[model samples]
Target: MSTTLTLSTFDAPARPLNIPLPIDPPEGGWTWPPTSVTLIAGENDAVLIDTLPTVEDAADLADWIEASGKRLTHIFITHGHIDHYLGTAPLKARFPDVKVVSTAATAGIIAEEQKTKRDTTTYSAIFADDLVEEVVIPEALPADGRFDLEGHDIIGVSAGQSDTSESSYAWVPELSAVVVGDIAYNDVHAALIETTTPETRKGWIATLEEIQGRNPQVVVASHRKADAVNDAGALAKTIEYVELGDKLLSTDPRPTLAEFVARMVEANPTRANVTTAIYSGAVQGLR
Candidate 1:
């Protein structure tokens, strides 16, 4: 049996709270950051990686999955970030029997985040009319750490702390593809709010190097460039952002957030989500 990999991207709506970038964004406003989801479809079954935050987006995703004419055996979340997994509840409500799986570490975070569920306050208080109002926790997958659909296998590789703790990627060896959640991003400013040190930055780069070592033909990320896909350039750009961050910050004077944004924006002027980088630039670069 043969298997194919498909991609889906859900661009989030603008947030109610405008990010306080040091200056007006290059485009003079915010960019709608997208959440990319991947589907591994085989002869008899399929596996989906990641979900968007909004109910409307996730329902569209569920419909897309159902229209594929394949049974969704498992939905694997690459990490536990609220935006990545918040829609799990709605997705499951649509596909009641589908198993929501995450790494053991991600599962812990989900359990804790859902237990308290304070994160939902932002959406309810502000964008109350936009999406689902619940968090659905996922169970840890089997100890073997692989999902088999039809006759193919999807392996999970742990990319520790690239974007968040307990983060990982789903590798489809048979198809030479890997769904690299936030461990890698393309043409979009990465969220460095979590990785805030030289050591951690190196760790982030190392994880990308690990993915490069596998030499997958396609690389999929949670946030991607317009019309982007899993490829060598995508991987290299991710490595570049982390490397540039460490180098620029290591220099004397420790550029302010605005200065850092100026340098980066000059180099990659066309990348969307410029506001995201500017918004978190100083904080991500500083100690």
Candidate 2:
């Protein structure tokens, strides 16, 4: 069964707009629904913001793209996270000629992670046991800059780090759209565990501000439904989430990171994963 969610575009000075791609995790051991893949249509070609988490999801997206009748010339990967990139192989297989764009750092990280995951017995057992022997590695990452797609341009920006060291961002000037990956999330709390320092959060905020400064018509986040945050509300929420993490880190001299996360979760029940990540990072720091 499939589900759909509609996100309305906001009217602001920048003219931000977005249509949310419905994604839910799969059942029985698989992360359900699926990550939303935003489609940014330019004058000539279309750019796929991010790939879903599985082959099935990628196939679904390909079907949608085919139905739209628009040429998908580029696939932009926001980061190296498995949830954001695992579906890439299928997409590449389907569109053998489309360029897969990302940062050099991100490409290296993805290649390393894919290699490690395929070789490690523990990782394979837990995540890919069903297809441990059928693992597929990705092709080379596109070099940074504007890649020609048919007659249009797809730009990959090395926007700097966020939750992960290799995080990257993409921009399409013609479409007035920016695919921010996990740099900016709406409604859901920010993931802090993957981030090493408050500096990383600051960098993320700075990047978002820069994107907004560009006044794009649409901004596509890696997770959550995509919508235009023309005003300050969505941005404010993002800042608030980061501030909350900082605040939690300030108080409580707890030694055990898990305990600290539990406390934070107690205070903010809605931010379970965010709290857990913060706790994990704190624990790692102590060690």
Candidate 3:
């Protein structure tokens, strides 16, 4: 018999960056929006989705999970972004036998991040003091993309592009929930750094639509505002943001990066991390 499941979240606070950016910093400095780790617990076992970005964060998350008194059976990474999987080593240290898996593509990307020293080089340029020193690339998930937790199924669906090229989300039918990594942002600026072009945005919109069609009762954004609600409505808001970004990029006599960011912020006045998300994307020189 399938055990009844409960879903919970550990929302990590925004990390202030050490690097300087072209735009004015917020309060202290530029900050990555807060990210979350979802826990799906059954009677005695649970599965974790997306490790946070740093060792200290993961250590705290480990303590939180330990308090739940459930055996962590697996750690499923939603994407290959350094922030998403960097905490794996600490979590693995805490739960030595927990399996860590991701899609082959994401695994390859994480492997590349390790091989290229992106953590110590590119990422280090900004979060030098906050990043985990060790790299932990997850093993590839089974081809079927299914994991069993107390007889319930958690499936991984491959997503073409979002904040990153190779991404995926976890689908848990038993709970009517979808752990959509960076595919959907809640009350935060959508990361446009990678998917600045119209075509890539279209693919992202399609993925969000697919998640919408599922009509999940619970939707978790990997990067979410602390106060934002976790519901399928986030999918529509994310699509709207992507569409607005596309329009802004295509404006005739295209707006200056400053102008572009101003229009986006005006449109999304309440969204957090305009500097990191909107500014960073525009700074990429998107046309």
Q: Which predicted model would earn the best lDDT?
A: 3
Q: Which residue ranges in model 2 land beyond 4 Å of their true spot? A: 1-34, 42-44, 118-144, 226-233, 254-287
What tens-digit string does per-residue lDDT give for candidate 1 at 185-244?
877778776777788888888888988998888888778764765586778898888788
Please give the range of 10 consecutive residues that has the lowest summed lDDT in model 3: 278-287
**Each candidate: RMSD:** 2.7, 9.2, 1.7
Model 2 per-residue lDDT at 227: 40
Angstrom error of the Cα, residue 212, model 3: value is 1.2
lDDT of 2 by residue, 1-287 (tens): 01221222211111111212232211232222113567665444666766765345556677777776666677767777765666677777777777676767667767776677743333334343122122234334556567654455667777776656667666666556666777766444456766556677677677667767877766665554334342334455566666666665555573455555555455555431342244344444632
What lDDT does each candidate get? 0.74, 0.55, 0.84
Which number leads on TM-score?
3
Prediction-by-prediction clash tally: 1, 12, 0
> Model 1 scores what on Cα lDDT?
0.74
- Candidate 3: where are CA atoms >4 Å away? none
